[model samples]
Target: MSLSAATLRSLKHHNYRLWAGADLVSVTGTWMQVLGVNWLILSKTGSAASVGLSLVLQALPTLLLGLWGGALADRLPSRPVVLATQVAHAVLAAVLASVAMSDPASMTPVYGLVLASGVVSAIGGPALGRFGAEVVPREDLPNALALGSVINSGGRILGMSLAGMLLPFTGAGGLFLLNAVSFFAVIASILAMRASEMHRLVHAGENSGSVRAGLAYVLRTPRLLVLLALALVLGSLGRNYQVTMAAMSAGPLDAGAGGYGLLSTVFAIGTVAGGVIAAGRPRLTIGLLLGAALLTSVAQSVSGLMPGMAAFAALILPIAAGAVIIDTTVGTRVQLDSPGDMRGRVIAVQGVVSAAAGAVGGPLLGWLCDELGPRLTLEAAGAATVAATLVAAAALARLSNVRLDRAVLLPVRGILRRAPAEQAAALP
Candidate 1:
């Protein structure tokens, strides 16, 4: 098969096609809502801190409920659970639109709606995370997830672009209204799916459904424990580029908002490109995951050393690409290795990682940027990620005898070569 064919093989399954297409629409609208809400907060309060707080409110639910959310994914039927969440999302969007339109002065209702939406996300995210197993076979899952990264990257670009163009005329309320409509796409798609065609995921047993059990599972599994540590470190330090990017624009680069926006656009392009390339991979391995992790962390360090804005922008492409590949690779490995009963909870830990990044890393990184400046701050983040990756490599080496070259380089070589689907290199 051609590379395009391989990348899109998951879409040949009827259910996944509908789900993915709808997800693209919903994701686009979700980004619009995000930009709209942030704009609304800033316009109302004229304080960047207030805007930051709004983000915290949106992510807080995941920290509080992520484990339970994953447990719910294991216990409940995805059709009903996903359907209900989509509808709740629609309602929340509509309410946000209403509040933005009717009472622009009241920040309380806006904050409340954001928190409620976060609650729904925290609960639904894990089910959504592992939903691909039901739609596509295990063999095609890696492609499905890589394609999802594409959808996400594309959606952010499209949604933010649309919101930027429409916001002046429609206001934040308009973007929210648009997002409200977008949810229907996913809801209808879910209802239309043929449940009979869905595959059963690998289940550990009835006794393995609790949140505590999920945590215990990760704690006991060497590969999983290493991955969890990698996620926390990489996610917190390596992935918080938004703050670092802005600081570079305003501080040493002195390029202002336009430069920040340009860098963001470039990063999005990189992710889209990376996701497309990653979609053609035949399998996910511990090797590919660690390689991508190393590439990302190391590239991050090199990017910090770039003296000019142009050089930095160029470097961010691989940084973003590596980040997406790492995400797709890690999520795929986690899902493949985990039993169905434990899958949601394991995936839900990713949410906890994200929340911790936002709560702990965001503030800490921000302080670093303020005190030490963006250049030094980026180096610190890069150093932190490099150290974490090395420690993880050492742990894996001890547990599984993972060799650096075989585990890291071979898979990356396969990726670069786009090895024939049947001939793709599979490494430890």
Candidate 2:
């Protein structure tokens, strides 16, 4: 399918609208909180490593706790799981805001609160991933997933931009307050959706044994293993974008927080665009995975090397686009291929891999920034990513009967039917 034509048809699902609306408001709060959190830490400690350390604290728990979260999701209904999580998140945000405002000198407690919030989010991640399948039909799953990506990245863009504006106005404390309010907005939206609208995925033999069984399934399936490997490699390398870009933009790039915000915004723009394109595509294939990885790596390399701001910004667009495409394709595939009961665990595994990346990547990049510089770190990582992509493609091609053409990712078999080619192409 042509890219232009595919965009329109992917948006017919009602679920996507609800998801997008909540996400639009919530994502901005997330971005604002992130920006404020970083600044708050930096101002208090006056150390780069502290900034990195805080992120490590926030993400490290996910590596340890994500699988458990997935297991819980499998045992429970996702609606209540998500709803409860949203409430917890909102309360955490409120606490952070109160602490930040009442005791400006006590940043340590704030970090503790952020760490607590991270743990809550780690548990919530799998539920959020599985929720898409519940809300939309199988046929619209990919599109819904893609639109989710668009909403997520679009939220990042607008949120970060607004963060840039709001942080200076209200200080980090005020931003936290606004973020707290936004969480309530998301919670309200989620509650407003009809219970009948949430359809649970009933996979064959969903009465499963242990989390190890899910792992066993992944291990037994060569394609799934390949996809997992791709996810691991991509997470390790791609996670460096934030640390590297932040350091470069603020230091050698001399762009400051605003520049960092601009860089992230460009990436967000690419993400939304990529999500749109992937939604319209016929199916997920090894070729698409390889292409996305290679394109992202190449774009990263170019962006890292470019000395001019405009050049770097332009390079970021393709990189962001590629990253989102890889994410959208892999994410949808994982959702479709897994059993409903085990889908939570599968998504949890993905989250754990990504969280593991954050745990390791942040400190590694920070140390690299201190020694070799951000550009060198980015260049090396980008090269490694491209190499990993090639290896993944080769392994995928070796499968005896898994032809790219035979793998139909669209219509999410046994799911809902979308409008034909005409409906797939329109935006909105």
List, residue by residue over 98-152, the lDDT tens digit for candidate 1. 9999857769899999999999999999887767668888888889999999999
Candidate 1 off by > 4 Å? 202-206, 409-427
lDDT tens per residue, model 2, 227-335: 8887877777775577787888977788989898788777777788887767766664445566667667867766678896778888888777778878887887787
By summed lDDT, which 10 consecutive residues of candidate 2 come out lowest?
407-416
Model 2 score (lDDT):
0.74
Alpha-carbon RMSD of each model: 2.0, 5.6
Error of 2 at 291 (Å): 1.5
Error of 1 at 231 (Å): 1.1
Best candidate (score: lDDT): 1
Angstrom error of the Cα, residue 117, model 1: value is 0.7
**How far in Å is the alpha carbon of 321 misplaced in model 2?**
0.9
